[model samples]
Target: MSDIKIYSGSSQVRVMEIKNILENEGIEYQEVNKMDSSYAGIFGEIQLFVSEADAEKAIQLVETIKNK
Candidate 1:
């Protein structure tokens, strides 16, 4: 199994914000988008994932951004 963790979801801007935080903190991550197709038009959720070892650190960086 893969040792990846999901840190956040929704909107591209939100995902990018979290990504920036992680990068500033020297943490590595991967972004995954789950797209949905429907009559209402296409939409998707953005997921930010990091290695298990960096999960805690990534979460912390996101939290810091949240608290600011």
Candidate 2:
């Protein structure tokens, strides 16, 4: 199954939190860093994805964290 994007953001702390949440839930995901290295914190975002099969649960978990 294809990977489905469930979250995207530029905050490292937030990103790490979500990653930890997913890991703790036993959800496998792929993280793509699109931040411009040369500019570091000046631009871009980090994206998180999971297989299509896991997308719904992943998105729900991420939303709960985001709403907190």
Candidate 3:
């Protein structure tokens, strides 16, 4: 299964929160440091990736957190 972007944000806290949600839900994922594209996050943000199958679920989890 191909990995796809599930979330992207500038806040490490936000990224970790989403990651925890995925972990709690048993949805596998990966953390991509968009910072590598710039000055090590000084000019970019963090990105979360999951398998294509988990992308939708991961997004839903993010939305749930957003609504809170």
On TM-score, the leading prediction is 2
lDDT for 10 in candidate 2 is 85
lDDT tens digits, residue span 1-68, model 1: 35576554556666788888778778888876674645212466667888888877777777887788
11-66, model 3: which lDDT tens digit per residue? 78888899888999999998978765545546788888999988888888999998
Better of 2 and 3 by lDDT: 2
Best by lDDT: 2
Q: If both were scored by TM-score, which would come out higher, candidate 1 or candidate 3? A: 3
TM-scores of all candidate predictions against the true structure: 0.70, 0.93, 0.82
Task: Return the candidate ranking by TM-score, descending.
Answer: 2, 3, 1
Q: Candidate 1: where are CA atoms >4 Å away? A: 37-42
TM-score: the better of candidates 1 and 2 = 2
Native-to-model Cα distance after best TM-score fit, residue 19 in candidate 3, in Å: 0.5
lDDT score, candidate 3: 0.85
Clashes of each: 0, 0, 1
Better of 1 and 3 by lDDT: 3
Q: Candidates' lDDT values, in order? A: 0.70, 0.92, 0.85
* Alpha-carbon RMSD, each predicted model: 3.1, 0.8, 2.3
Clashing pairs in 2: none
RMSD of 1: 3.1
